[model samples]
Target: MESPHAVLLVVLIATFAICNLVQAEDQEGFISLDCGLPPNEVSPYIEPITGLRFSSDSSFIQSGIIGKVDKSFETLKSYMTLRYFPDGKRNCYNLIVKQGTTYMIRATALYGNYDGHNNSPKFDLYIGANFWTTLDTGKSITGVGEEITYIPRSNSLDVCLVKTDTTTPFLSLLELRPLDKDTYLTTSGSLKNFRRYYLSNSESIIAYPEDVKDRIWESRFESEWKQISTTLKPNNSIGGYFVPQNALMTAAIPANESAPFSLTEELDSPTDELYVYLHFSEVQSLKANESREFDMLWGGEVVYDAFSPEYLNITTIQTNTPVTCKDGKCNLELRRTKNSTLPPLLNAIEFYTVIKFPQLETNETDVVAIKDIKATYELNRITWQGDPCVPQKFRWVGLDCNSLDTLTLPRITSLNLSSTGLKGNIAAGIQNLTHLEKLDLSNNNLTGGIPEFLANMKSLSFINLSKNNLNGSIPQALLKREKDGLKLSVDEKTRCFPGSCVTTTKKKFPVMIVALVSSAVVVIVVVLVLIFVFKKKKPSNLEALPPSSNTPCENVTSTSISDTSIETKRKRFSYSEVLEMTKNLQRPLGEGGFGVVYHGDINGSSQQVAVKLLSQSSTQGYKEFKAEVNSSSNFC
Candidate 1:
C-alpha cells in the first residue's frame, strides 16, 4: 500500500511523461538539426522559445569540421555550434522524407568569427542540384535564415552548401516541416519565402505552438496605421493554411477611415515572379447594420472585388496566377466599397518569389540502382553525396550519365570501379541500370561466378573482370553476348566448368612449378648459348686485341667492364629458389602478351619485383628471347 503523498507523486510523474509524449507526437513529421553539435551531447534538445526538439547533424552529413561560435555571440543553443566545410567545393545534407509530400525547409547561418578571422564568408546554397540562392554571412554575429516551400520529387532531399569563392561554407541549423499539400499552391515552381508578417504592435517573433507549422512570423507595425486587437481567438479551423489564431487577433487599418490601406514592395529583380497571400480577420464586433467590405487592387487593377471578412473568422486571399512587378516594384491597395461603412483591415500577409527548378533529377530507377550499389559496397566517396548527375560540375566520380535532353531525367550510362578494392560477387543492383553501356570492376578481389544478369543488360557492350579471384565457367549468356561483339576481358586461366572449379590458391601450385621450371630452362639455354658463342669466337691474342675488336662475351668476362659486367654477373636461381623468391607465385599483378607477371620480393627484402614467366605458346623465337633476356638483365 502506498502513502497518499507517494501516490500523488506517482500520478504527477505520469502526467508529466504523458505531456512530454504528446509534445513529441505533435512534431511527427518535423526534422530539426543543430549543425556541429557534438555527437556525444544530449540530443533532442528542446528549444526554449519554440519548444521544438533539435538533434545533432552528424547523421545527416558526412563531411564538415565541427566548430563553435565565439562564446560572446552564442545567443541560442542552435547558434552556438556550426558545421564548416573547407575541403570540398560542395557539402550536402541528405534527408529522407515521404515522396510527394509538401515541406517547408529552412536553413540558418551565423558567422560568429568561429575561426578567429573576423571576415565573414559568402557561398551558394542548392536544393538537390539546382541553385537556390547565395548566402552572405555578414561581419556581425547576426544570423540569416532562408526558407523554401517545396514538394520533393523523391523520398530523398539534398540541401547543399557550395563554396563559390575562397571562403569556406558553414551552416548553423537546418529544419524541415511537413505541411498540407494544398496550402502553398503555385502554377509552376517552388515558393521561396520572401516575407511573412503579422500586423501587430509587439516586437516578438511568433512561431511553434502558436503556428503549428513553426513558421517564423515576424511582427510588422506602421506608425501611421491604426491598431485593432481582440482577446477572442479567430476561427482558423476552416482553412488548410491554419494561420495562427493569435496572428489573426490583431489587425492594421488606415489611420484615416476614408483612405485606402496601401503597401508597396520591391522585387529582387525586374523579372521576378511573386505570389501573395493576405490574411484578414475582423477584430471588431459590429452590429448587423454596419459592415466592412473592400476591393483589393494590385498595381491599380482590381483583383478581388467587394470582399468581406467574417467577424472573428480567418479569411485568406491568395493569387491564382503569378504577379510580375514592373520596374522592380509592386503595389497593393485595399479600398472600402460603397456598401461598406468601415475601413479595410489586414491581419497578416505573406510574400513568396517563384523559383523555377530547370534541372531535372536523375531517373528514379537509376538513382535507386546506384544508391543500392553504393550501400552494397559501402562506398564513402565524398563526391557521391548528392544527385549522381545534374548541375554538371559536381557529377559523381567514375560515373558517366546521359543528361543531354534537358526535358528528360538523367540516366547512368557507365560505371567504373576499377582498382577500388571491391570484394564479393558483382552487385546485383548493376543489372537494374538498363542504360549502362560499360562496367569496369577489374583489379579487385571479387569472387563467385559472373552473374548471368549482366547478359540481359542489352545496352552493355563492355565488361572488364580481369585481375580478380573469380572462378567457375563464364555464364553461357555472357559468353554469347561476348561473341555478339561485347568487349569482355577476363582471366582465361581462372575459367573452368561450373562443377570442376577450384580455388585459385589450390590451382596456383602446378602453374607456379611449371613457370619456375620454364624460367630456369630459359636462363640455362641463354647462358649455354653465350658460352658457346664465346668459345666459337675465341680470340687468340686477347692482350694485343683493341678494346672495340673484343667479342661481346670478352667484355662480359672482364671485371673492368662497367655496364656489361653487372648484366653478366647477374645471379641465376634454380626452380626452387625462384619459387621461394616469388612466394610460390602467390600474387599475380597482371597478365601480358608474353605471360603472367607475379609480384615478388627480392632476397627477403622490402625491395619489390615483377617476375614474368614466358608462356609456352609465346610466338617469340630465340632472337626475341635473347633480346628479352638482355633487356631484363640490363634493367636489373
Candidate 2:
C-alpha cells in the first residue's frame, strides 16, 4: 500500500507542471490556423441573434412563419424586426478587431422551416468590420461548415456571416475565438510588466520658455523613469507608450542673443541612466561630431561612464534595454545605481549649449498710396433738401451703382442721371474730358440748347435725348463733315450731342441757331448771288464822303427785289492769329450782350478795340463789320 502524504505531494507537483504547460500553450497557440488551402482556409466570425441583419447567418419569416433558434447554450440577444435583403446588404452589422491580435471565427446554419416552408437562400461568410469595405474570403454554403484560427487586431476583432438570400433572413449564431497572428514557441513571463513596456514609448524635448516649444522639444528621449511618473497625467507626446531601461537626452538654448542664460546640471548616472525625465526647457541642436556623457550598468548597478571631452550631439537615445520587471509600475528601476538619492540641483553642474540667430530687417516699398478718399455725384431725394450728391454717404438711396460693386464710380461704360434736378445747361468746360462714353440726362429740370462743340467729340457712341424741355431741330451739320464724326439723338425734351446727353430746353436756342445756319446756308448763298448779278450800274454818284460815315451797305444796291437774302458767309483764318489777338484771349476789357472789348497792340499803340464774333457765325457779320470798320463809323 502507498503512503497517503506521499501520493498528495506527487499530485501537487504534477498539477503545477500541467498548469505551466497550459500557460505556454496559451501564449503560442493564439493565432489563426489558416494555411490558405481552399477548404482549409476557414473563416472566423459570430453573429448577433434576433435582429434586422444582412449577414448569411440571418433568415426572414413570413406572417405565418415563426423564427426558430435552438439556444443550446446561453447567449446575448434582443427581439426586433428581422428585415435585410442579402443582395442589397441592408441592415448589416459590424465587428471590431484589435490592432495586433489573432482570432478564429466560424458559422453554420441550422435551417428548418418555421411554417413548413421551402429551402432558404445561401449565405456568405466574411471576417472584418471595416464599415467602408467588405472582406473577400468566405464560404457559400447551404449546409453547416466549420472554420478555425482567425486573427484579430492587437486587441479584439469581429467576424460575420451574410445571408445570400434575396429576401430577409434570420440568423442563429456565429462563433469567434482569439488566435495567434504568428507562430511562436511556448515561453513564460509576467504579462503585466511586458505589456507596460510594449505599450509605452520613449521621447524627450527641450523648450524655449514657451509651452509650444516645450512640447516640440519633448520628442527625443525614451526611458522607464518617464513612463511611470507620467501616469495619471496628460501625455500627448509621441513617445508616451511603454519604456525600458534605456535613456536618451539632448540640451539646447533659445534663439535670443542678448538673453542672459544658465546651464543645466550634469546628468547623474544612478543605475546608468538614473534621472531621465523630459522637460520643456532650452534646446540646442548638437552636431554629430560632438560628445556627450554615456554610462553603462548591469543588474541594477552602474558599471562605467563613457564621457568624451567634446560635447556631443544626440541623434538617438542610447541605453541598455529589456530591463527585468514584475509589473508595469516601478518594478525593476535602473535609477542612479549607488549615488545619493537627492534630486539634482540645477545650479550645481553649469553645463549646457547655446547659439545666436540674427534679427530680421525690412525695407520700404514704392507703390501708389491712398489718402482722404472722396467722391461726389447727383442725388435726387426730395426728402433731403440739400444737394445729396456732394457727400455720397448721406444721399438718396437708389442713386447708386445698380450692383453697388463698390463705393466709387461705376466701373462699367454706362451712367444714369435720370430724374435729377439739374437746372443748368451742360457747361462748355465739360467737353475737356475725352473719354465720356454713354450718357443719360433724361427726366431732369434742365433747359438749354445742346452745345454745338459737342459734335467735335469723335468717340461718341450711343446717346438718348428724350423727354427734356429742349426745343430745336436736329442740327444737320452734326453729321456733316464740317461738324465732326459724332451724331446727335433728340426728341421733344431730350438731346444728345457728342458724348453729352442734354436733359432740357436751356441748350435749345444755341442748338436751333446751328441747325438753321448750317442746314440753310447754301440756299441763302444762291439767292445772294442772284441779287448781286441783277444789280444795275449807277452813273455818277461818287462824291467826297465824310470820313466817319454810318452808311456802308447803302452804297452797293441789289437790282432785283426777289433775289434779296440776308445770308452770312463764314470765313476761316489761321488759329495762330486768333491766339495772338486779345493777347491770347486773356484779360478781356469788357464782355457784354454784343461782343468783347480787349486791350490789343495795333501798330505798337495800345488801343481798346471792340471785336465782335456776331453770334459766333452770322451770315452778314463779315461784310457789315468790315464796312463799319472801313468807313470809320461809330454809331456811338
Report the C-alpha lDDT of model 1 over 63-96, residue by residue, as the tens digit: 9999999987736666789999998878899999
Candidate number achieving the greatest lDDT relative to the actual structure: 1
Lowest summed lDDT window (length 10), candidate 1? 540-549
Per-model lDDT: 0.79, 0.30
1-636, model 2: which lDDT tens digit per residue?
A: 111101121232332332332211222222221111122222332112211112222221111122542333122221111122333332222343454443434433333332234445454433332111121212221223333333332232333334444534433334344433332101211011000011123322121112221111112212211221221222223332111111112222212312212221222222211212222211223365532233333334554444221112112122222232122222111122222221111000101111111111010010000000001223322222211121233232322212232233322223355566555665443343344455566676656676665566544564555557665544544546234434345564444455455546757778987875773454235324423432332221111122222434233243221243212211111223333444554555664442344443322222233333323334454345345433432221
Candidate 2 residues lying further than 4 Å off, grouped into runs, are 1-66, 69-87, 129-143, 153-170, 180-636
Q: Highest TM-score: which candidate?
A: 1
Ten-residue region with minimum lDDT total, candidate 2: 364-373
